[model samples]
Target chain A: MTRNVSICAMAQIKNQPAIWQHRFQGMLMECFESIMEQTQVTFDMDTGLRNVVTCSDDVFDARTISDAAVTDVVGAHFRGEEKVAQDGISALGYAMACILSGHDDLILVMGHCKESQSESRNMCTNLSFDPFYSRPLGLDYLNAAAFQARAYMEETGLTDAHLADIVVRSRQNGAHTRHARENEQVTAKEVMASPLVADPIRQMHHYPVTDWAVGFLLCCEERAHEFTDNPVRLTGFGSCMDSYFLGDRDLTAHFALKKACARAYTMAGITDPEKELDLVELNDACAYQLPLWAEGIGITGKARGPKWMEAGGMDKHHVNLSGGMLNGNPLMLGGLARAAYGFTQLQGTAGINQVTGLQRALAHGTTGAAGQHHAVLILEK
Target chain B: MTEKTTAGLVADIFATMESRVIPEGVDGITANYGYIITGPGGGQWTVCVADGRVTVVEDLVTPDVTTTCANDDWIAITLGKLDGMTAFSSGKLKVTGDMGLLVAAAGFFEKYQPPLAEITVADIFATMESRVNPDGVQGITANCGYRITGDNGGEWTVCVADGKVTVLAGIKDPDVTTTCADTDWIAITLGKLDGMTAFSSGKLKVTGNLDILSTAARFFKKYSPPSAGPEEAPEELIVLKQVLSIPQTFATGPVMGHFLNALKEKRILANQCPECQRLQIPPREVCAECVVRCKEFVQIGPEGIISTPDVAYYASPDPLTGETRETPYCSCHFLLDGCKDHETMWHELKASDIPRAERGVRVRPVWNDTLTGSVTDIKYFEIIDD
Candidate 1:
């Protein structure tokens, strides 16, 4: 009865040149086929399938009708399929819901985005807001983050150096990943010298728009053995949504992350995430979110040092080892890529960036106007 | 003079024409044109026109013709919509753009476009639909009345005729008239419910017009809210119809790849979830229940039970195929056998099967026999005995 679902097979296509010409749907199908082939799964036209969840938004121009395009790409021909209306992390949550519902055994979660095809900065206007008020004021995601980052700095006395350090370390680590985007790496001084997008947030502090697709395969214990010799069990998973309006919540604290982390820890039977988890993959779309979310997740202090170089501490819990979103953010794909990166570390397939003796890892994903929605997954080998 | 200096020198040409004032309506009259007008709060309106009468305002001392709209409305209508043409057509707008010089100057101002691009027609339609009373809401269209007392205690009754708002004569017996600050009235008209919510919260005083106030809940629906025009269609509808039209085919190498290509042939196929061990008629990446990866694909016979049946009483023209179907075409959920239990794919069923297509009825996928792995492969599934 012990089911083993390893990271049996995982693949990511990032910043590929072919995406420039081919339709995004075609690119997605190619990615899915490559993953399936690499995993060596037999194709049965009739039975033995579950659900497919796609992560995308209407704003992304690559596939104007992303949901239908994804359904067609993922082969949800006559099967149950759904698209997460929010970011990619929410799609992973939908897949998890299907698993817990006793409906299907295997689930495929995929998310991808091509920022080059659309105005990435303008995508912020699409986030849920009172159209009459916020949108008319010329407010956008960067400016909103600037307001929050300034608030956090004011509240905690954290400096721009802290953020710069994060960008430096993440880019350096990203340089080691096999699929790292070329010329994406940058140094702390270079990050600091970069032009300011908004007050308190430099251009280098934000994640870049790189075309990417990340997919994961999940299964029940019964069929888990069929896929991989060593399965990585989904020890626990939790997600929560905070107040939809940015003005309603405290900027310094991610209340959703705290609640999500608590539920995940409780389900995974871990008293201390710092002690139990060997590696951590946090969604750091902006560098300032790193320390704030760390504090929110209760991973602060010496047991596990901060991921930034300014902290001057190297603790056991390796964070953002795959460079997180800073190096290559494929919008919908960033969250799944974070989760897959965590899984790769746990499965010992994290080529150059692999952490030694990594057993348990924490994968976190966030969405919404100001990280208002959060999802935490605990994967243990 | 050089062309640039000559153009600058022509600025006073209108004054020169009027001083003759240029031999009143002489044939082939030629003169440069421009105008300057002042408004409340020292607002200045200045423009340059090549020819024709330039009416500044209606005042006898001013110009031949002057048109006016609420300044804020004028600004919003100009900056927000597609401009003067739409503004004038909507009647929320009025302009002297009809004047010859003003009409010609419209081209000069074209370079000063708004920062944001115009919203698509479909988006505007969606905005209007969401803000307006949707089709199903009851009591949303009832007639309502309201009375407002101005600051000097002068009162006026407002009647909503058809959907356009208009001032009505005062009635001794009022429907609902509550005295409130002009700010609150402005807020109410602007669609802010904070003042009203506070009124209901017992902060602001209200009296005779309580029903009218309640009816104002439909105000968002009353005004023609901003909308994307009819020209833009929802992209999803177009894609969905395209996928539905193609007949299903059964050719297969990579299941998903084959399925996408099969759309051109109109065939639909199902893949099973390996975790739940159910036959998923259409293949997918994961099972809904276990969150496990479904890598194995099995081709099940096109068939199963009708999980749900929705009969359409009206048939709108399908934009993609550009065809109008007969009314009462049935959309049903067909749960293919051997796929995940309770999982079904949606498809159209014929009118003849409507009576028999109750939930739980057995249905078999009637394939097109061409064998392309597309959803349309089996046209509509027919009711079959177990």
Candidate 2:
């Protein structure tokens, strides 16, 4: 009995002027109802059998003991509810694990964040290198990224213009995407001229903290078939955790991401990711991550190798078609939203940002201090 | 030190004064004297009196007792609804000098009962020069109470007043509520829940408010403590206190004595798990993996590589120390030189030549001149030769 798994429906609630408490529970419930109505399927009312999971970290917000609030808003009443307490993409991977465990059929995974409630910038820096060693030197995530970017440029001769192109293209795609905020547009020249937040990486290169609530309804193959005619199957999934502290790993390379991508490609029988995948919704929280991730995931051409972007190879592969974190990052929900965007693309229902005849798409998420943990999921039509 | 003498007198007076009962011949002895108590911040108070007419000064010269609690709480007590004795007993109110004067003045209130109508909220507000502004103070009022959902799906409510914490009906009795210094309460309230930091760093102390201390966390609403003036850093000295019972595990042995003695020598030591060979820093009674007693003591050197480092560009003055921690101190994880694999100690790295210090940079131990077995004996780490 070979069962297939697919994304049946998805919903996202991203409001510019919304508080955390306002959007948490109602947004999830509304998404649940909308998915049911759109798919024309009735969910179990008694058991609440649809497994639910939430992802967040204590250090990220004032709600240090936030699991209580999560359990309440997630409606875990009489259900096997769980919290990842890590990052958003890790929660998605956990939801998929629940399906693999054969415990439930339909699974709803949600991630919500409100960085506006606290001093986010300082807190973000607190998660950087050791306070005694790196902090006194004013070394934050921005500075660390600059170090890695400078190292990459020195080693690979990649220019800041290449990084600007990534921002320009991502924002251009975001302009057409529903997930993007209205009236948000940018150009390569503007991205280049943007104030240097951490030399080589300008202000436009990073994602601003946005408020969002995103949910996805995943089902087993039989159940997915009952909901929609063009069900997008989750062909493969992989994830890896690196050291919690960033100094333990090399900053120049994303080993965890590479390992995760290898696992996903092996599961999906993807020999050449650059050609096999129709689109990619990679974790481009910063602009530099694009080229670095492209090289790491074996998306680089064999002949040109490091100069994949120069060859116009990325034109065929749509990366961060939903503006990415650079456009509108919702902290805990950003990674899951990236996966949802990829799933929509594979289903041929991305709406305004739809890519025609999309068969296979890759979604990736990076978590913890400096992308220490990586998660990759492959979806096929 | 001059303020210390006045603070001592106040403490003595309060300790000996008749709290609830007044003697018949106490009328002539009841006299009001001006008081100016100051702590870290420029906290000052002036109490004025003439011929049975008691008038507290409005201008802030130096506070008689400047505490870390919300000014509204202070006003509430002055208005008579909130009991001052209860606040002091709960560790919310801190007094520094003129204990005798405070006790005598407090005694005057007991001896000659003041009319309730004389003291008003407006008077207290005028003195404090601030009106009640409830912008982000939530969860304590009638509409918003402390909501706690238990592990078994039970709901609980908590109420805090006059420095006392009470669990509402239907809520299970809390495990522990500790009464500590007001500065400690403020630190814990401001989301610094690291118990080790509070205890080992001497930022907190516990007394009668034990039950409230353990459970009733200090939740703050954007309250920043007053800045501290620069002063010479105290020379390293080890102060030995009586060994209290180790928490969690009750293993009886000389391991505790040995660890304490090691601190006296300014040596960083850890208990090695015989079975797993894991080095447990701050020597624990039980190993985290095997859950068995760690009997062997391993002397680890004070140097290692910087595992992780974070730069702090902001400063929050430590209330208890009455000094501001230098901004941009390196908070790094040092893997002790002689420890087994994956064993590291966390400490603040001295910010000298920080530009050269990176993730894999080796660091050496900088011991205090005074050696005691306490954790602070190691002072702060400095960059070392590989």
Candidate 3:
């Protein structure tokens, strides 16, 4: 990479179902202040923070151009600001692009989502479908994922029991995480017996609805050292979009994720993902997605997710040390949370969730129904 | 021949076809035709002319040829003012099913006259795309939904792409959706009722992006609100009300379930983590400090000391249920027998204990006569002088 973008600082509040006493702006302000407090990066129109990138959705935030809603909190003092209405991880890719393009140097990336604000999160997701085909059929992310899960399970012969194991590990891992929603570990029996939400998928199979916000300060390599002593460079970024119609896609295939990872890895000069990367922080919105997405990103072999999930495999592999997506984190902000956790891991400030010392990490996030679009990033210490 | 609607125009074409002239240079053509005239005055009409007999009906009859266009264009085609070949040459008139049949159908009708222009609320929406003023939203695409109430009770979806607007009949996931009474909407559009007045009076409700809708107003040509008639305000208004019932259930995981169930036996249990020596009064799964699972369940105090107690002078209303509990109640946290300081469990203290509610005060759980496996099984904890 010509000019590597490094993360100066990162901060986030623990995932909460609702923070009714205060507004979302306050939550974002706290994250903003915390990041500034760590890096001491001030926003000066002359030579400091230049542009801001925000990850938000009109439907999710119940408003359009949602970045404009958080101006006072994030980058009102900057030279420019742009909002990406996709998943949070995608905004990181966009911010990196802006820096590489020589358009801006220091960029503040903030992402937030609150599932507690809406009556049902599914209602917001259902609207993402094309009104003609999918919306008429009442398709949402959960049911669409159920279709993918069923197909993926049928193809790999994965069962509901295997899903329980993933949830148990996710919850157990979440216990050690700083900002996890469901921290208590559960047995396979409890997870399997949990109420059936979308057949073959118990309630525990999906990510819990949470309210969270995260922020990161990024700058070029030279500018990075000025901000922080320990700076992790963002070497590669790739994002791709797939078919909008669920019928058009092969339910069992993570072609978009694979293609995105291929582009990102190629840029980072990565030959082997499993061997090269020290840790992987991925948005596993559901338990099924963890292994399926792991395979999608070329980490594990086909149908080998369960094997890699064996008691100590994740710790050995250094995956989702911040408990990953399923334990908590809102939908749009899931990827950003993953990136925040990854940044913390590389910075060696992950506290209890920190794994064995590492050098390289992959952060990933997906958007749209049934993972129609995927984004990947490679950060190095 | 003088009917004002597209249906009337089709009726006149069929009436002219009844006498039927194949033009001096044409031959007897056996074919069916369908016309989907657009705009506010538009509708579906079928024209079938076979062996000198002509039939026209107001329905979508899949025919040998179908021409979809605006109502005015169809009228112009019938009147021969807009050349049939020219309309087809341009994209203004779209022909599907069979191309040859359209020319044949054009020859099927004779000397028809175009009618006067008449527009309606429906016309504004149908021709919305044609009225786009691209300058409104430089380079943006957004969906805006319309839900009209009272008489014109129907839904419409409008998609504004780059500077053009396309309107359709039904709902679309929108950037901003607006709901308003039909009368108020018409009054606002036609320049009769003030948009702000309608909005303030609760007649217009908008969700999603409010700015998008404001920008969308400039996307189209200015709408002329209908002229208002003399009106008088009503002295009284009736409000409609209805009751709703929603059932909800919550999960109390294994740890909390054990704590609640043990209440029925008048026994209190707490879990102690091996990594952390401190025990929890109410058994929980993982210890926050150690991040380790705690399975060692030890019986906590039926009798314990009060770690903290807040005797409130006034009751705080439940925000959700909108109800208030009795005031001057002492809400206390107890450090159960097995649990140490800082591992206190919270519950309400008995009314009599409110006077002595303070730090270092000992309390004991008061069990109800009816043993139910729930939190309510134990009444308020009473102060015990030890």
Q: Choose 1 or 3, whichever is better by TM-score.
A: 3
- Residue-level lDDT for A170 in candidate 2: 76
Candidate 3: give the clashing pairs: B190-B224, B190-B225, B191-B225
Ranking by DockQ: 1, 3, 2
The whole-model C-alpha lDDT of candidate 1 against the native structure comes to: 0.60
lDDT of 2 by residue, A238-269 (tens): 88888765567776666888889889899889
**CA lDDT of every candidate:** 0.60, 0.61, 0.77
Looking at candidate 2 chain B, the ten consecutive residues that score lowest on lDDT are: B243-252
By summed lDDT, the worst window of 10 consecutive residues in model 2 chain A runs over A15-24
Error of 1 at B334 (Å): 30
Error of 1 at B237 (Å): 31
Q: Which candidate tops TM-score?
A: 3
lDDT of 2 at A15: 35
Candidate 3 residue lDDT tens string, A10-70: 8888898776543566567678878778887766666788688887777666766777767
TM-score of chain A of each: 0.91, 0.89, 0.96
- Please give, for residues B209-271, the per-residue lDDT of candidate 2 as tens digits: 344433333322233222211244466565432221111211112554566578777767788
